[model samples]
Target: MSRPALPELSLLMVDDAVKAALLEDFGRAGDITSQATIPTDAKATGVIAARQAGVLAGIDLALSAFRQVDPSLDVSVLAQDGDKLEPGTIVARIYGPARSLLTAERVALNFLSHLSGVASATNAFQRKITHTNATVVCTRKTTPGLRSFEKYAVRCGGGMNHRFGLDDAILIKDNHIAVAGGVIPAIKSARAFAGHLVRIEVEVDTLEQLKDALTAKPDVVMLDNMGPELLKQAVKINKGQAVLEASGNVTLSTIQAIAEAGVDIISTGWITHSAPVLDLGLDIEIG
Candidate 1:
């Protein structure tokens, strides 16, 4: 079935990069295997089905990629972003020239599967927090050239996104701490040089450093690698003076306990960096 036109679509730079990569993969010619095996004008229809339960993401971009190959290719979305899907659920439908569909198959599935994986991981992390005002967030730990897409997927799965880049926000981490001699100097330099609108966050590993960070009065304090009890104590010390973010070695199993520690934000690197690709496949219907 032909899907209705998507009214408004925002294109991130990552989307453009993905489209470029797809074009590069296709080259002046298309998939030679599909071209050799399938007749040029043969028509086909298929469903992109999920193989496991997951929060759906990237179908819109996948649809866009398919259309880029052939405007005549029909795409119908059976599910939207953030929707939970069971195995065998048809997330999308495509009807078009068999050759074009086959040619675009890998690119389409690659983006869809990876993005859905990110969304699924974010959803799992969010599920861990039982009772807390803290929000789960994703870090700069994202796939190269795909950061925007991955962050978008994180949002789809109910997680917040940190600064998209160094330009957007000033985050002083441990390395910066060492380079500047300590958290105070790093915070001082960032605060002095940063524009009035810029917000600075400093990461600290110890309560003593937390004290130093507090003196600097940063916009946020990142509690790195602290256990649950220590995190709660850190929260108590902050006393709402600065926003609190917990990071380092976060996992789904430990997130709820972390959130309950009263931190304002939890950032995980694994959700985008190491999330397993969601299982998806395009099955063609022979008629």
Candidate 2:
């Protein structure tokens, strides 16, 4: 499948918000060392280089962080979002005041590293699954304020994104199941309450519940915590009736096995929430 396109203006706007947050993080004072050691009039050039192999993302946000510190800074992108990078690869080049560069360094690195980590994790999961028609997907397991950027990184890493927010889709989870007393009732209430355009997905923990959910004709069915062998059986039972999404306790080691079971989508929380930060750094080029 082709990569999804993100609007340029939306990306820029998100970058602006991230920049504001970074400014709040620093307040009036800047990096004390750069402020003390670097001349106020000092001009410097540098590169934000990756220290390890990983997928690159949040290039725009990093650039915006630097620009917020100093708009006149000349920023050039050597790698775009979704680009896979090797160690020592220069992802971006910046020429500006030494102080602005130093001040923006942490915020920029923070976003870059986190986003790269998400993308890296996502790519590894996507690599699993050989024959079955299953797409790797991400859940709401994202950084609180950075959902858009993190989901964008998921897309960059070749994984599909679930609903960006609760408003975007209706997922009747276990709590909904309890409130309604069963999967069928929950799905029924969701269908009755949801707008005409809204689609309802229901989560089922067992084949019996899956059957009930299928009978109710949900838009999607989430097979919660089902292992690969069981998932294959569920897929057989589904037989294209509704989109099948396998979720819970997913890991890189198990993803390929799960995907081969023929689930339509696999949602893993670890990609965004548990991935370690990809190491990156910005080193000043002395002139």
Candidate 3:
């Protein structure tokens, strides 16, 4: 089945990211190599092609990078984010000043390749547990400045987002539990300050801790590093008291086992932090 459309990323967000990247690349000199080799009036056509098979993402951001560099450039997006791609697929085509195309090439490919990698990795994890009730999720362990973009790519690959940030939800981790003295205390502390609308989740490393956490009646409990057998036990103990989240040591090889254990959500940092970059190249022809 074809994947559903991904939500539109904010234009303002894309523009800001592209502008920052271009500034870092251009600095004061601004594309010295292109300026020296390409004439001011020189024109070129370029095709952004995938060098390997993977899911496509960040087409808009890539186009924005080019437009931000030169508004006069003609850009045609041949594929949208969330589309599955094969090697040699033309993701986008650009025709404009050779200098402008050259200037934007690296930055555009950086966004496209990195976000597509995130989508592809997410898709890999999602595909592993398609028959189960569990859903794949992304964590905050994203690139320092690219959390929003990375999380968006997760959704493009048919995964759900956990929380956008700390303010969106109260996730009481092991550190918080220790600081507050225990799971119940941590839940209580969060409940005291957080509004009633906020859902509280706590991470527990043991079934004993899970039992203790369940008594607090938090909205969700994360089973950290638990094996499938332990996860099944936790699910049985939960008995619909709270949502179960499986995290830690999650990989493409082990994800299916974790999902089969009956957890409602599985979150991993690898998709955003360590995913391999999708190989894409901008092949240009100067005229």
Regions more than 4 Å wrong, model 3: 285-287
Please list the C-alpha lDDT of all candidates, in the order they appear: 0.87, 0.86, 0.93
> Which lDDT tens digits does candidate 1 get at residues 32-145?
898789988899997899999998888767887787778899988999877888899899989999888887888888989998999899888887773668888899988777
Q: Write the per-residue lDDT of candidate 2 for residues 53-127, one digit (tens) a residue.
A: 999888888887888888989999999888889999999889989788888888888888998899898888887
lDDT of 3 by residue, 126-227 (tens): 999999999999999999889999999999888989998989999999998888999999998888988989999999999999999988889999999999
Weakest 10 consecutive residues of candidate 3 by summed lDDT: 1-10
By TM-score, the candidates rank as 3, 2, 1
Worst 10 residues of 2 by lDDT: 2-11
Best by lDDT: 3
Question: Poorest 10 consecutive residues of model 1 by lDDT?
Answer: 1-10
Q: Count the backbone clashes (under 3 Å) in each candidate.
A: 0, 0, 0
The Cα RMSD in angstroms, rounded to one decimal, for candidate 3 relative to the true structure is: 1.3
Error of 3 at 268 (Å): 0.4
Q: Give the TM-score of candidate 1.
A: 0.93
- For model 3, the local distance difference test gives 0.93
